[model samples]
Target: MAATKGSLSINSENIFPIIKKWLYSDHDIFFRELISNGCDAITKLKKLSLIGEYEFKDDEESELKVQVIANAKDKTLTFIDNGIGMTAEEIDEYINQIAFSGAEAFLEQYKDKTNEDQIIGHFGLGFYSAFMVADRVTIESLSYKEGSKAVKWECENGLEFSMDDCDKTDRGTKITLYLNDDSLEFANEFKAREIIHKYCSFMPVEIFLSNPNAEPEYDTIPESEVTDKDTVIETIVEEAKTEEKENEDGTKEVVEVSPATTKAKILKRPKSISNPVPLWTKHPNECTEEEYRQFYHEVFMDYKEPLFWIHLNMDYPFNLKGILYFPKINTEFESVEGVIKLYNNQVFIADNIKEVIPEFLMVLKGVIDCPDLPLNVSRSALQNDGFVKKISDYITKKVADKLSGMCKTDKENYEKYWDDISPFIKYGCLKDEKFCEKMSDYVLFKNIDDKFLTFKECLEKNKEAHENTIFYTTDPVQQSQYINMYRNENIDVVILKDAIDQPFITQLEQKNENVKFVRIDAELTNTFKEEVNEDELKEMTDKLTEAFKKALNRDTLDVKVEKMKDSSISSMITLSEESRRMQDMMKMYGMAGMDPSMFGGAGETLVLNSNNNLVKYIIDNPEGENTDLICKQLYDLAMISHTPLNPESMTAFIERSNKILEIITK
Candidate 1:
């Protein structure tokens, strides 16, 4: 048949130029697109064979394979495939019309919602991507139909392409791209090999590239001289004697011995390269821990085994599969990097998927495979795909479930990792409401005694002692002295040290009724209600306030007296929790124009007991130097308990201590 004489009409005259210049950011993607198209054609042919629509040749080795050949001398790169080749008419219909998508039509016709293995390229322009790196492209193909004549199609920069019948017998397509001057690198063997390995290593079809420098294996045989004499030896002397005795009766049976030929040993050839199988596609139960560890090392190059792992497999709403490994994180939290890698169809999409998982969970290391991601034409394109939200939610739930399971089965191990993992979970709860709801049950709180307890357990244990209050301290070391005082009084205090603790506690306070977090050194008054009579408490407070003002010069100490529970004996200085927390924030932010003296300078209220002997002595002799010294010493001790004091104040306190020691020695 004569070549069809018809001109192709494009949506726009500049369409080809736009595609060549802007459709793909990377010129190397042209090879991936072309090879992907070849794989799709092969898949179509296999489907046709399976359905009995076409008769496949009865060849022992008929598997589909893609071959990439680089001819630097000819300045052409050829991509060949054993797929269902198109005829002259089919070429005129598909190749001539660039935008006509055969994949789109196939999907619309089949529409198997459950099958996710369908080919990815839906647009027919994948072939045209070659123009990005080629000045001219030619296609030679022979149809699968018997006696189908071969055809060739050629296209340059412009739309004026020529088609003609060609003399070819191969039953597949061979696309040869003439490299442009600037794109000659694609014709280099090394460069082409690299590009193929990066984009097509995981492709279903086997890809072959010419390796001229590869060494060949050979077998060795020992040299031997041949002897001309033909001799026959028999080892039948004993056997023939027994047979002769039996032959007297039988008279017919005779034994004959034959010599067997021996061949030389042959050596097996060594395998060159082994292809790595994608483990992300396999079922979790079928994989062993060792296999998972090996796969992790292959993908991440981390020799150390993971601490734990979660295999995520979900199909509803969206398709997702991956194994998330929690690597051994021993270094500072800030040093952890490149935790999660995103993959689509067993191909790595990106290593930094910080947006996919919550920022707090950034320490988690693993891969996430979601086939529904709307990758841009470049396959490198990442959009705010609607499916990403669902994927994120699913991952968050899985992580929460794993953590909850650990807490239930291995409490000690969970506690060991709690400090390191708490920051992430806290941040997740603070930022993601849904994640918080799922993770709240597993959040562990450590009390002052070094015991780990869940929030509900802590609340239950302290219900009676800490009525209408949830006391928590930010700095355990700074406030440890107060813990002893509270413990002595049978009050429970939780240690909350993270930077986010203050804000988180505040949020929890608002959410929970009649419950609030108060710093250990926040106030002189006890968190629990006082058992002393109101009249007696008022009398003691007035006397202690007057005596304290006289002992420490009234101008230096802005001290207010309040009666605390009898269990909290003598006296203690306290700063309001909110005020102290704000000061910490101000210091962190380095807010300028703020008065430094205002911070650490606020007057602490001093609650004293009139019944205590120290209080009685200070009140009876307020004008004495002994009273003044004791007042300064007590205040300094209180400051030391909350935070380190200035050098000047510390020196004064030390000097006073020495003087008291000298008096005792004398």
Candidate 2:
């Protein structure tokens, strides 16, 4: 082949400048791109050998290795790799042509049924990322094929490039970068070593740093002395005959010689920082308890042994491997970011993969590895790719399956984790429809009496009496006074206190058929089942509202007096479920800091029970002088039963109680 010469000619004179300015944020990535190409070439050669297209020499051990050498005096950084080097023709075709990738062509031709492991590179732009940090780049390579001569290609600013033959004996490629003034930092050995360790630690080949004076380890030993037993015995016998050893003053004793001591040798071992065996890459069944616990601690330094773990290894729609842990949720602690780490080929891409996993799954602490995730020209590119979405769906389904199994086999344990996992599950149910549908069967609802039941079970237990309505309370302590009221009527009120419960319930109500979730403290909760005539109820409601307004100053009692069934309570202060839930959510999202004027609202409504005798007496005896005092007392009692009352209002009520006490004393 007569050199197959070619030149890279672009339409615009400013194209190289545009590429340098807009395409890459950093220039060091160029090294990654070039090294990746070398790896890809080696991978292709291996595949060719497997298919009998190429044969390796008996003496030639083919293993890819990347070498980085920095010349501070020359302001040059060289990245060398011993892999399948390109030929003169390949240089002309692949190197001379900008934006044209051999990897892309290989994938386009063989991607349909080819093994992905055999293909590593995609875009040729990785080479260009180097331009971000370098002013000039030179390539020196010799084709891996026998009888191929070495070639050299040089380019500056991607504008003009030259290629020629060079005398070389190596079967590999070397990329030398002339660092720009701004990128001199990468010319240091320490910086280069850091980059290699970070980006290429787990690369297919072992990367060696050229350390000329590397420290050597050795063991220290002490000399041991050999003793002559006969000589020692003769000396001891002479000493015993010549002199008597005396102890203190009165008694004579024989002296004995002490043996010499010897020191043990101490050996030094090489330090290893890399975790060669990643936990996710291992078989779940083969992993021991100690291994999983150690891995969890290594990944999350502060977290204790996880409550439980889920090892997911799936290769269907996409290849995925991960070990997810259900960390013990400390109710007192707030949520933290970066709990789940996302990995590509056993290397962590980032600790915070919020986009990869739903925000609700943030409570999960684990690692996820997927090799098929697509990266842009730079491996640094991170976005919600198709494979990521598919993997997320798979994980969600797996979690639901696990929970469902646990619920069936271990009800008590499942219930114990329900409160801790409820916030995450409810948030997911409210945001992700697919997850919601799958998780609906596993979500457990706890009643006021601390009994756990699934949604379906609760509905079945209360469908006939409550007319398919599910009544829940946000604060069980505040709503306990009304629990007996509902119990007397054989109605079950679910206890839900999580900040996300309101929105979750609303979403559930929308999805469920003919189902409603009414708060236990909502207006008309006591009369939900009453069957009264509209006109007669309206008359009784109006009379009661007027009487209460007169007995208690209307400004002091912000209430809605309504007629209820004879069995219902006399008066109760309640908050609308939606209003309360919205407020809770607002606080959760940091919206509560706004001025009160922004909300344009007052306090919640007070529902007065007209059927109670105490309320009826206060209404009928409006002429009595103590009517206002009695009405205020009743209002305070209702407010206390519904929720914690305002401190100022409680103080005023206390003073009023003291006055009544004084009267009784008189």
C-alpha TM-score for every candidate? 0.71, 0.71
Q: Distance (Å) between predicted and true CA of 286, model 1?
A: 1.2
Write out the backbone clash pairs for model 2: 27-132, 27-133, 30-130, 570-609
Query: For residues 1-666, could you state the per-residue lDDT of candidate 2 as single tens digits?
Result: 344344575434224443576665655555556656666776666666766666877745434456667666678887777777888778766766666678777667666646766355655556767777788989999877878989888888866777788876788888888988988888776787777655554455445554323343444333232222111111111222334577787799765564444433332322322343577887898899888999888668856667677898888778888888888766667563438877666544556565567777777888887778776555555665676677677888887777778888988888988887788778878778887877788899998778998888888877776677888887777787777777767788898887677778878788887888888776565444355567865665666666567755574445566666643466677766666655666687898755333565445666766667776776677657766777777778888888787889989889989987887799
Candidate 2 — worst ten consecutive residues by lDDT sum?
229-238
Q: What local distance difference test score does each model get? A: 0.70, 0.70
User: Against the true structure, candidate 1 has what lDDT?
Assistant: 0.70
Q: Write the per-residue lDDT of candidate 1 for residues 230-348, one digit (tens) a residue.
A: 12222222222223234656767545553333322233232212132466677888889898898788767787777778898887888888888877765554465546777666554
Q: Residue 21 CA error for candidate 1 (Å)?
A: 4.0
Please state every model's RMSD to the true fold in angstroms.
Answer: 10.0, 8.9
Candidate 2, residue 554: CA error in Å?
2.8
Worst 10 residues of 1 by lDDT: 223-232
